[model samples]
Target: MSNEYLYIKVDKNSMAKNKVVYLEDIAKLYSTDTDKINILKKQVVLTIKDNKPIKCVFSILKIIEIIHSIYPDVQVINLGESDFIIQYQPKKERQILKYLKIVMVSLIIFFGSAFAIMTFNEDASVEEVFKKIYELIMGSEKEGGTILEISYSIGIPIGIIVFYNHFSKVKLSNDPTPLKVQMRVYEEELDKTLIANASREDKIIDVD
Candidate 1:
């Protein structure tokens, strides 16, 4: 390879679908030398052991050193994060386990939300309020089944749909749901925490 510069753009976080990770898996190459780029793409970068999922942080400094050692004449330019994380996970997970987890989480959410709503209603004396409203409008005492109670029951779910901006697979708008936004924030924080802890855990890949 002639003495030339190669530009690589990498994100702060990347996913490796399999145990083995390559240069192409984490970084985008920008160079005129297709052959050299191909060679670099095939280079072994990281491998997960025991067929287990893992996340590891790596510094681009060591990567640059490695590239320079291989092609001393070629300069490597970094156009992305100085350090990044590669999360290794298998593409195919156990279907039964996956479904089981989903079911379990769904059940928990259902029960938990039901409990919260019930507790709130009890605290606010919703039954007494409904009875008074019923008496005031109908000029009589309210029994168990009334339009007020029915409407309140229906309105709870509708309010949830409007507040959450989601129901089943349907979306009320283009904006992401509150749950999705929170999950994304959680994932971003997790990635940052993992990257920050890598060096302390002696799991950071860097120049020796």
Candidate 2:
């Protein structure tokens, strides 16, 4: 079927009580992306009777699944008594840009925290603290490499690496990485917000 045919709105008053519309047909109406079209094609058709969806033939959950595959932010709102509305509010994410943002934020947090720690260390500036530590370990007289100085320099970076789990992506112990935990919490909050905001149409109807 032509892409245009998918979008042709069916008049609620004219639609037969037992009319059947394929899920593929509905998916096509909303999305022109080839990948999404292929996904929709595999779904079963939806049957409408007296304008109410005939249960057992296709569940609301299934309908939600198909819709989310295309428009993650869109919602299906039941207006009751066979009346319904498709609430479309598309959310777009640029993968490359998102990753870049995460990297930038991480770097800022890492450096900012490091600077703060250094600043609070007995009122010593970061550069002065480093120089003093080096002088104490290596001795002011002998400028050559000392075991303590080398170890201290290497250990600082190593400690940071281990704490951040930069290379391994594995936690030092059973406890989750702070970044992972934060991301998970953010995702949970976002999901809760979406669920809470999903039925705006229903809320409006009730208020009226």
Candidate 3:
């Protein structure tokens, strides 16, 4: 195939002053022996005598510095064609409310099912199951709805207090303090690596 040539309008000021050299001219200088010269839209190409073709299409300034250091007499001629690389990243949301809703609904369904099973037991009445639950909770073996009546007046508030206290003790670490959970996780990972890499002599051998 016939080699295609691009007529690059050489900058008079750059060549005259010998200040900032354009990269496009570098390719043409090298193309005297080779026909694979291309002038990409935004790039600057540079080639030094007896050296590999230096493709400098992105940063014209950096390319000029490189060329002047190696071949001070050489001027940039043309930039070469290169594949542009790009990457994309996705954002993640820590939706605590969404997670909490799912957990709470699951808990309610599970507990409600247990409640239903207990209430519909062959020997136990709805009143009886509630009475048993109350007795278990209130530390009372009362034979009547005295516990239920008490629970309606006082037990609901007491249950709420108990639940609040338990919830507080759950230690979700929601406070603004910077806990080293990541460090602990790293330590666990290190331990796993150590276990995986341990020599047979270093491992605890189970003697029968």
Residue 108, candidate 1: Cα error in Å is 1.6
Better of 2 and 3 by TM-score: 2
lDDT of 2 by residue, 1-208 (tens): 2322122122111212235555544332344456654665656544444533321212244555555566565444433122222222223368999999999999998999788776675485644556677778767744555565577668888888677666565556676667788998996565444434545433312211
lDDT for each residue of candidate 3 in 101-158, tens digit (9 for 90 to 100): 8899989977986676666653556566677777788797777557465555485546
Error of 3 at 149 (Å): 4.6
Q: Per-prediction TM-score, please?
A: 0.86, 0.36, 0.20
lDDT of 1 by residue, 35-144 (tens): 88888887778878867677789999877876776777888889998889988766677899999999999999999999999999999999999999889989999767
lDDT of 1 at 161: 98
What's the lDDT for candidate 2?
Answer: 0.49
Looking at candidate 2, what is the lDDT of residue 196?
43
1 or 3: which has the higher TM-score? 1
lDDT of 1 at 125: 100
- Select the stronger candidate by TM-score from 1 and 2: 1
**lDDT for residue 86 in candidate 1, whole number 0-100:** 88
- CA lDDT of every candidate: 0.86, 0.49, 0.42
Error of 2 at 202 (Å): 4.0
